[model samples]
Target: MSSPAPFSRYEFMIAWRYLRARRAEGGVSVMTWISLIGIALGVMALIATLAVRAGFRAEFVDTILGANAHTTVYMAPQRVENEFTDDVYVVPGRIQDYDAMAAKLAELPGVERTTPIVRGQVMATANDSSNVAEIFGVSLDALKAMPRIVDPQTSQGSVEDFDKGVAIGAGIQRELNLNIGDKIKLIAPEGAKTPVGTTPRVKSYEVVYVFSAGRYDIDRTRIYMPLAEAQDYFNRENVADEIEVFVTDPEKVDDWTLPLLEAAGDGAQVWNWRDASGSFLSALDMEDDVMFVILSVLVLIASMNITSGLIMLVKNKGGDIGILRTMGLTEGAVLRVFFLCGAFTGIIGTIAGVILGVLLALNVDGIMAALNALTNGGAWQPEVRGIYRLPAELRAWDIFRAIGLSLALSFIVTIFPARRAARMNPVEALRYE
Candidate 1:
């Protein structure tokens, strides 16, 4: 007959009518707006938090890569107990033919460059103050190739100049109150044992350059010296403790891992920056996941508002529902009307929140800079409160998951109220009217 009136169209029209209805006409109510706002706020929190976590991870990875090599070909530590002192020595396995090994690694695809490095820790003394600093004995050419490792304008001298002396981090200079020409002593304890109960291998170096590595730890406690000079200081002449491998993509370190290790042969072990900082990275990921779950409670709480609003709407529309049932509206159709109403609130809220969150994430850096400037009354320090500003990376999947989960929960919450409305007794519902 009349081609069973378009049920879907009828449901949508009825749902929209109810949504747009005035308070007197039983249209969308105050509860619905409250529920919508709640959902919106929750979704916004989720997206923003996820973006920030992503951003922090990305920034950390880049910083690590900048300060360290993408991959290091080194000997695994052969832990040896020092008979002279309580200190335990972790001597790295050495690469005697590092030059040839580096050349071989450089031939591999994706390898940007390879540099032999003498890496160790040394006690640095300046201004009569002493602190242990991480040291990298690297070629001046290699140091020059590293981005942000040296800033010539601010630096007192060039990388080549470091061969005659040493380049220290700005933090070191500030802490020791030493100028470019001041002398700093670097003492390596793993030196030759003399009659004087193991004399510390020590060298006095002129601070020829000052570098700002953009990382608080690096700026405070990292030093670079000419490779040959470092070798002499550590008593490892004509040998390198490791071969630092730089690659095009630090994130894809695995791709080059096996190939590089294979080229280096059996004695050398290849590891990436991630391996060196696995614990920290794992903790970051766990923190992000925990935050997501904790923040999701906000969305769940918001969905309860949808349930409350739907129940109230059904109660107010009992008479209209009675009439629809009497006119042969199926239970499923009746359920869908209220379902659509609640779903509409969730969909709108999710969309709005996602847009707001993304916009905030994209400009978070600038926002933080302005806020910091206002508070500090000056330029924003990159490392204020021991943290850089929120570095946000918004991902499509994160947004999609947030919206999907919110909408699904919203849809699920509406079912109870919709079902109750659909099952109402028409006679009793109409008797009151």
Candidate 2:
């Protein structure tokens, strides 16, 4: 007769019979249940952690890129020599002919759009409230195109009146108690120049728009004004402080540094978002690695239950194994049967974990909202976390990794008990009975 194929139907049937046996009859049913639950919980926890990490990182980076420039080109500082005193002084550079330069930079590879910005710090006061604001001078067209500023989900008011007034962050509006069409006074410390000295420039503009960038700091402190108004307010005429460059891909910004510099020409310096936010991104990456290591240990611990369960099953079935071996069962068949029992538990557990994790990830926002409501809106603080909401993004690779790790551990731990069952002496096992 031909030898039976590996892992035949009989092996699976025997494994199922052993798994279903009653605990009172020397069965390991309780241990099997415990092992399955443990593995499932561990896998679920790992998947959830990974999803949160990914979502947090993505949201953080998205806010950064959307609300700010991917890269900025500024005029390099120039050294000026005093002819009479024979002394040298460094003067802050200004980007004159910025329109032409912005147009040139927009043509470079991977360059999305370029906007000339006049930036300044000023005190905003309205309705007996005052706050410091970092103002960016941008064209109405650019303001409308900006991702965070024009986002319908978070922004209120209209940019049509932007040229006639100013757009303020939601935080600033709340602090100053200002609303659309309300006048807000901006006090610039370095203002008009007179014969005697300079005076602080104080001007009032109507709040034409309000926006939320989904970031606490940005939404709290940023303001957008018309380019002409900002230029006049900041005493910059026919010049720009810097050119903000958006790119096709913010992550590959470094690759465009040289090209941007070349396009910007001499007396220009380049700075990218990475230069400003690299340390924070690195910290996030470190946190992700640490979390994965910690959760992997949890999975390993849970898989230990599988080893214990399989060992008990091996002991309880010793008599059955001796009879089967005497009848005609091969040692390999005995090992396969026991291995199938543990593998089946792991497979089912991993599938259940994946389902649970995906469901949780998909509903994370609703769950967080419910939790926050239960805690009286204390569960999530945007100011503390720097994000408006808790985010959870389920990635296919993360789920696959969780499944792989759990199954690998289960198989490894099951080996020892399986080998022990296969090598048992039929005569000795029968003698004990």
Candidate 1 stretches greater than 4 Å from native? 3-10, 21-28, 76-92, 148-160, 178-183, 190-198, 255-258, 366-387
Question: Candidate 1 — which pairs collide?
Answer: 21-27
Candidate 2, residue 134: how far the Cα is off, in Å: 0.3
Model 1 C-alpha lDDT per residue in residues 314-429, reported as the tens digit of each score: 88889999999899887888998999999999999888889888988899889888887788834546555223556899999999999888999889988999899889999888
Backbone clash pairs for candidate 2 read none
The best candidate in terms of lDDT: 2
TM-scores of all predicted structures: 0.85, 0.96
Predicted structure with the largest TM-score when compared to the true one: 2
lDDT of 2 by residue, 1-433 (tens): 9879999999999999888968485448878888888888888888988998899989999898888999999998899999999999997789999999999999987888999999999999988889999999999888887788889887778878889899999999889988889999999998999998999999999898999988999988999999998999999989999999998988999998999889888978999999998999899999988998898898788778878889888888889999999999999999999999999888888888788878888888899999999998899988899998989989989988899998998888888899999999999889989
lDDT of 1 at 176: 87
